[model samples]
Target: MKSGFPSTSPFRLPPWAIRLARRQQNSMAGAADRMRFVIQLALTNVTAQTGGPFGAAVFETKTGRLIAIGVNVVEPTNCSLAHAEVVALANAHANLKQFDLSAPGMPKLTLVTSCEPCAMCYGAILWSGVRNVVCAARGSDAAAIGFDEAPKPKNWVATLEDRGISVTRDLCRDEAIAAFQRYQQTDGRIYNARKGLT
Candidate 1:
């Protein structure tokens, strides 16, 4: 474990990113608009050289008010679990002060991600208590840029729906894919599990 005690900003998102999110807090309503916001975040993360080109946010399901935002912090935090979706959810929990978003009196939250989540994030959504999931790019888009998604279920979408969490995919897909491509063109680092380990 490589660590010397984490600071207050646990996820370590860029300062500008934190500001941008604050300025736009609860600023989006439509799904396409929200997707655009997160896509921009992903692009900014790449250009900022902070982490990977992935972004995610939590929103109130009914009103579409952005609750919290997160960009990838895997390499910076040296923790693979710091994926965008996980960070977003964790931030939401912290801000809302509720481990289960669906806890009584809590707003029904939605997870909006710039791209389809990997196996780990997919599992996170199931336990996050979010009522809905909004996705921009497909998981294959992440894979094209040399990211590993692990062995996520093929029926993942249906699976979430079965659990009462609605899943919406491809909300501004081309734009999200563009963000991934931008990362690739800029030679952004692609970190995944060390192959041939097990």
Candidate 2:
């Protein structure tokens, strides 16, 4: 019998495969349950050293099962693309072993973010194969909290819907806003790239 490639080889299994193999599957009740779970997880990032007051998660739409979670990592590290939604999507892809998230035969998935995705994260969602999105606040809300949000085109939600992605805004608007407020109150750094300009 021929032996497989050695484990010490440079070409090792992907991180997602290892994570999936080691972790237990997470199952939830439904949309409401999953939303609550994601909110709680996202809130924990409110005090993170790098990214504060932003959180996101991925869920299986049909099963209502939690897949992966992520928090913003923009400041303190200067990673412009480390939005909560982007991190969550990356985690989902890693855990599910599906880099091309929308590939055929994949389970239906949803991206739940504490705030509406900015322009970059919006693009990530469109290409991430998640057919549904649940958001706590809109881009304006994040801007209101002192974070610089990129401009979005008119009828953006409609555009996503037209592309077969359903978006549900304001899952818990007040609650989500409260997180940003808390961060602001605690003197959290607001890394606005467009500071000092109109």
Best by lDDT, which number?
A: 1
Residues 123-172, candidate 2: write the lDDT tens digits. Answer: 89889889999998778888887887787777889999999999999988
In candidate 2, which residue pairs get closer than 3 Å at backbone N, Cα or C atoms, i.e. clash? none
- What's each prediction's clash count? 0, 0
Once model 1 is optimally superposed onto the true structure by TM-score, how far is the C-alpha of residue 109 displaced, in angstroms?
Answer: 0.8
lDDT of 1 by residue, 60-173 (tens): 877777788889989988998999999888878777767898998887888899999899999999999999999999988899888888888889999999999999998999
- List the candidates' TM-scores in order: 0.92, 0.82
- RMSD (CA, Å), each prediction: 4.8, 6.6
The Cα local distance difference test for each model comes to: 0.84, 0.70
